[model samples]
Target chain A: MLRDITLGQYYQTDSLLHRLDSRVKLTATLLFIISLFLVNNLWGYVMAAAFLAVCIRLSHVPFRYMVKGMRTILFLLLFALVFNLFLTPGTPVVRLWKLTVTKEGIRMAAQIAVRLVLLIIGSSLMTLTTTPNHLTDGLESLMKPLKKLRVPVHEVAMMMSIALRFIPILMEETDKIMKAQIARGADFESGNLIQRAKAMVPLLVPLFIAAFRRANDLALAMEARCYRGGEGRTKMKPLVYQRRDYMAYAVLLLYFAAVIVIGRILPI
Target chain B: MALKLEHVTYIYGADTQLPVRALDDICLEIPDGQFIGLIGHTGSGKSTLVQHLNGLIRPSQGRITWNGRDIWEAGFPKKELRSSVGLVFQYPEHQLFEADVFSDVCFGPNNLGLPREEVQKRARRALELVGIPEALYGQSPFELSGGQKRRAAIAGVLAMEPKILVLDEPTAGLDPKGRDEILGQIAGLKKETGISVVLVSHSMEDVANYVERIVVMSQGHILFDGEPRQVFRHKRELEEVGLAVPQVTDILHRLSAAGFAVDTDATTVPEARDTILKALGGKWDGPAAGRGAMGEKEKC
Candidate 1:
């Protein structure tokens, strides 16, 4: 059951988006999220939706698989929808006993929900197309200027990659430990809230111990490999901006400029 | 009582883009008090099959029955099934978590809701059964040696007192001496308790040494199910599936091919020794006589 989580999971496919430089994809995703917030009316949202649709199609990621990532944030989406629906102070369209559903509130809620969904889909698309190593390389390269200000950009990137690498490993480990505890007759299900929380002690303790042991082993392995710092290390696949990246940058700039113009031209 | 799997099939990542059949149409009966060894290469569904025995995973296509009762029926008491069919996973030592070895061992019986005194009694018995000294029971499990941690983990499951013990590669990642000690204790436990055991191992020698029946799995199918001697006889078939016969059995086949009048059916060392001695016809004179007998046997 723990296997259902697809967080940071990359889907392998031979597509134009998958072949794009990780930095280009990352920058485009960031710009896409910014465009979602910058838009104010239906036209801008339509443009944003069209941009995302085109990217998703080009990536060759199945629409169903891309939507699966939304399940994890369903609760957040509902929460945002409800808050915007009920709490927004606008002209009431439907008056109930104490709550008023306004037309503006409905529009606001829909826009907010769409923005949130687009935000998640945009980020998930970046992760789904790029591998963790490529993502790290992109992040480190993006943060390279920070190194001049005494920031440990390489170390942070290394830690991020390691953390990403261990997510699936730890997930499998947790599943194994949970099964082991269950085989020992530990009841994790069918218990009261406190009882269930108490039962997690058995699961958590072992998981923590295993995590620390893995960390120690990883540290030792790195040390044995003469891994000093990220100071003077060269990447096997160095990040280079290709023509496709420039083309992607041009498209993102056009989308951002159009969204800004639409937001300024359209009345709320 | 017997555990039965009827046309059982399990598919991992079913309904996903890439579904894999981990076990396919497996039908087998595990009778009470029998020692069975499950041999397969990695990813051959050996682990998936054992997990099904305890209702840890429901089969994608078939039914599993415990003593003629379907385990997946409504209100079937899955917890009881799991407790009764204990599974000690590979690298089980990573599961140890309690403050001390004794408490970790007691985790199983305690989970069964046994009285405190009874839990303590079972925990001690399990610790003793796994050869964990009483004095070390109070020590933190993390502080124990690698082999001791593994034993404590096994004891944790043993304290559950399952009727059927399923161990998946129990001796994996251990030293040769450690492996023998763990396997020896498991064999002794099965003998003493008369509980059924399903030992999943890649080592043909370990299986040949302990189990009465060996079930060979390949590509999610049961390739062979018989006594070790019978299964090892199909050495070529087993090798095709990336498995090998016991070292002693291989040696016997080599000796037979070297023109000796020795039987190649021996699966263990003692059996091979006996076969070689018997082929010599009890001749006792000196090393020269022994060589002469061997030469005569080779000619024949």
Candidate 2:
């Protein structure tokens, strides 16, 4: 039952986006999200929508998997849409008993909905195509220049990678603990909110202890292997920008430029 | 009373793209007070089948009946079934969370809404049954050693006074002394209380020594189900599925293949010892003289 909960997990498949360097995908996602806010005109939205569609297709991640992440935030999207549609002031399109649906309100709701959906899809594409280790490695390499300021970028990256690695292990532990507690007649489903929260005490306590123990063991094993703060450590497969990576960066820049230029050129 | 699985099949991720058939039309029955060993290699669906025994995971294509009543039938006494068939998970570390060992053991009986005094009484009895000394009962469960922690976890389930105790690899990752200590205590507990036990383990030797019946599984199907001696007789087929007979049984098989007049189905240590001694002239003076005693014990 716990296995059904996916944390925007990576989908295993071979495609052009999967073959590209992690840094390229990460940078492309960032640029795409930035352009979502900048693009206001109808043509600009069209360009952004087209770009995302192509990226999703190229990534080879199932559309349903990407949309699953969107399902969790559906409430937030609806809230944003309702707030924008009824609260914004402009020419009235429809008048209800207590609220006015204005033309500007309609435009605002559409714009925000498009941007939010595009943003989620774009970011999830990166995660779906890249493994957690590669994503953190790319983040570390991208932030390497900050080492001059003693930012501990490598350590932060290592911590993130370890945290991601433990997600599934901890999930399995939770499943085991939950079943064990259930067998002992612990009632989790029928209880009121307060009682349900109280019932979680058995589950949460063991989970926290298991997580801490695992982290402790991991640290000791790393130390035993002479791991000392990632200093002068050469990676077995070091990050290098291949031809596909450069092509991806160029395409991303061109798309963002088109979106910005269209927003500026189109007055309507 | 008996727990029965009739054509039970469980498919993991059934609604997802990559579905896996974890249990495929398994049919088994567990009668009262029977010490049954569920032997399977990793991912042979032993854990899934154990969950079915207590109604934790409902079968997708079949039904599980407890005492002639469908467990998944509407308004079934599921809570009662769970308490009746206690499950100790593979690792004890993930289950014990109370401040002290005594309280941890009390959790199960407490969940059953037993009276306070009765809960304490049952918890104390369980701890004693598992060989947890009273002096250590007040200590934090986390402070106990690995084997002690395991025993405390088992006591937690046992405090519920289950008719059937299903333990999944209760002795995994322990020293031999710890393994033997825990298994021996469980054997004694079964003998004293007459509680049925379904021990799920990959260790042939451990199960052979304690259980009356062994059920061998391969790829989500039962391959063999019979007495330990009867099941180990198919050692070649068992090994093909990444499971082997007890080390003693394998040694006896090799001895018999080498033309030593010995039977290959003596799975336990004592049984194999007697079998080998009787083969080699029976005149060797050590424990060979005690063959009659061992042979007499096996008569039951």
Candidate 3:
């Protein structure tokens, strides 16, 4: 059941966007994220929304799945909304007791809500289309310049992929442990708040042990296979830019230029 | 005591786009004091079937009965049914949580609302039954060796004193000696306590020497259910579903087909040896070759 909360999981369908090089998707996502910040006007927001809709349609992933994990970010959205709704200094829109919401505050909050939402959806699109392996490869490739500063890009990338890979395995382990505990007459459903927290102890302790054991075994297996650091290591499936990837970059540049023109360069 | 399933069909993610019928029209009966071995390869719904035994999972269709009454009836005590049919899951040692083996084993009895003193008594008895030393009772379960942890985990379930014990792959991942010890302990426990057992396992050889009956499942259907000799007779059918009969059964079957007057139904190694010796009229008087049968005749 916890596995249903999968965030930005890949949609396994053959589509133009899914086939694009991971590097192109990553850079396009960055450009889209930058565009979200650059555009403040309604027309700018409209362009961003349209671009996102087109990308989502291209991805072939269901609209419902794209927003399934968004429920988790509702608290963060509310926090942003509340902060921006009353904190800006401008002409008063509404006064309630000691608190007054300004017109500029309303404007800023609305723009922020739109921006935050579009930003999440746009970024999630990249992850939705690219497999975790490709995502890591793209990240390592993108961060190659940082290797001069000894950032350990490949190692970090490997860790990210490994962590992603472990998510399902850990979830399955948790499900089994929970069932085992339940079979032992450990009641988890009917308890009050404190009772529920106390109940989780039986579930959590064993999970941590299993995780450590798995990690230990994995480390030994890796060591046995002579897995030293990322030093002088070459990739089996090297990341390469295709002709379609270049075209995607071109389209992204055009989109960014349009956002700047409509959002900031022209009079509102 | 009897637990009976009637036309049980379980479909996972029923409302979703791709619903998997894990168990389809599965009808099974567990009578008292019967050591029934459930055999199947991976994804044959062996685990799902065991979960249903203790009312941990409810069937989507049909019904299950405890004794004579329906388990899904309006006023049935589900919790009572759970303890009545104890389930020791595969790799059960992972469920140990208490500071010591004694307390961990007591966890089930405690949940049963037994008195503290009684819980302690049951824990001790279970630990002894599983051959866990009294000295190790107070030590952390984490410190126990692999086989000890596994048996201790089984003791945790046995503490409930269930009438029917369902163990899913209890001997998996252990060395041959450890496997034999655990299986022997289980068989001994059944004899001493007179409790029914449902051993869900992968190895036909392990069950061949131990269980009275074998239920073979494949693709959510019971392909064969009878005594070991009768069930293993369908060797071709079982192997088609990615399951193999005991090694002795295989050798006996081949020998019988190869014009030897040997009984192909011999499931255990010693039984096969006797069958072949009788057929050949050869006196296997070699002291080492004349090994006695390790299994006792299980009376149901």
Candidate 4:
């Protein structure tokens, strides 16, 4: 039961996108997010959706895993549908018991849902190919220029990397703790709302304690390893922007231009 | 009575392309009221195998029977099954959260939905069984020392009154003295309560000294299941699976190889000593050795 929770966790695979420089992929994801928001028409959305589909294929990530990521946003999808369905004023499609379901409201809700689903899928695809370490390394490399402003970009990246690495460890720890409590007859499944919340006290208290202990130990170990923020530190695998990265960036620029032109010519 | 797994197979993400076979056709009968040791390296499926005993994990492919009844067959109360087969996981102290030790230990009996008076009684008995004194009852479990926290955690499980207590790496990270105390407590509890004990450990000495039966697992398969002496006899086979024989047995084997005439099957220090003496062609009090040692002691 514990294993079934979809964490948007990446599956290891060898593909064109997987082999690309992580910096390029990170930049592409940012561009893709921007492109998703830039789409104002149904045709633009269709183009964006096709782009995401091609990216997913290039990454060799299963479509099922992408849908798993969308599962977390299911509630938001329904909420958006309801809010748009009722709140937005439009030409009524049907009237039922003081409620009017409008054609424009339905179209807007569908568009919003499509946007959200696409956003989750696109982001998940990026994460699915690029490991958290590589992602952070890319971020650090991308943010290097911010060092002139004393932004401490490397420190942030390091912290993110560490947090990503510890996520699975902490999850495994939590699972073990839950099992231990269950062994002692802590019923987390049954009971009313208040009773269920009360049961979580047993699980949460220990989880917090374990998490703090882990943090302390990790800090001590890092200090012992001479980790002093990200200052004066050299990476083992230094990031280098290659010619292929430049080519990829150029392709994205061309795609953005194409999208702008297509939006004007084929307005929804 | 026995806990039996009949060709049980469990897979994680079985429908996915990258399905992980956690347990593969595992079939074994764990006898009643016996101290059995499970040894395996990490990811060898030892944890998955034990999780089935209590129905914490249901097998994807075969059956689990307790005393000749299929546990997975409809309408089996899995919660009741779990209570009957207690599992004390590694670092179990992390499970403690109640304001006081008593309340925490009572959590189990309370979950069984027993009468309040009966729950308190079981809590007291379980605490005593784990050697946590009544004086420490009102104290917060979080404030206790590491070893005490571990004892308190074990008491929580003991409070459930399980017929079979399964502990995974119970003595891990404890000092030798603390390890012995906890291991000794579990052994004593088994003897007193007549409950079957399954101790999962990587330490060969702990298992060799405490358990009557040793079960070796490798790559999601039960490699061997037998008495300590019987399992250690196949030293080559065990080593091939990245497991070592008990230290005393290893030392005895080394002694025998060096022409000391010690029996390699000797699993304990005292047994090894006796074997060494027999190999040296000498009695406990040899005629020349006893006289010389006595004369030396008198001169001293």
Candidate closest to the true structure, highest TM-score: 1
Tens-digit per-residue lDDT, B192-261, candidate 4:
9999999998767787887899998888888889989888998888888778887768877787678786
Worst 10 residues of 3 chain A by lDDT: A1-10
**lDDT (tens digit, per residue) of candidate 1 on A179-213:** 88888888888779999999999899989988998
Candidate number that wins on DockQ, 1 or 4: 1
Kindly list the per-residue Cα lDDT of model 2 for residues A85-199, writing each as its tens digit.
9999999989999899999999999999999988888888888889999999999999999999999998999999998888889988888889999999998888789999999
Put down candidate 2 lDDT per residue, B1-300, tens digits, no spaces: 889999999999775567889999999999999999999999999999999999999899999999999999999998899999998989875688899999999999999999999999999999999999999989999999999999999999999999999999999999888988999999999999998999999978788889999999888999999999899889889889998787778888999999999978787767688788889986768685466665565443
Candidate 1 per-residue lDDT over residues B256-279, each given as its tens digit: 888878888887666776787777
Predicted model 4 interface RMSD: 1.4
RMSD of each: 3.7, 3.2, 3.5, 3.8
Writing each residue's lDDT as its tens digit, candidate 3 over B74-129 gives 98987788888999999999999999999999999898899999999988888888
Q: Where is the poorest 10-residue window by lDDT in model 2 chain B? A: B291-300
lDDT of 2 at A235: 89
Candidate 2 lands at a TM-score of: 0.93
CAPRI band for model 1: medium
Please list the C-alpha lDDT of all candidates, in the order they appear: 0.89, 0.89, 0.89, 0.84
For residue A68, give model 2's deviation from the true position in Å.
2.0
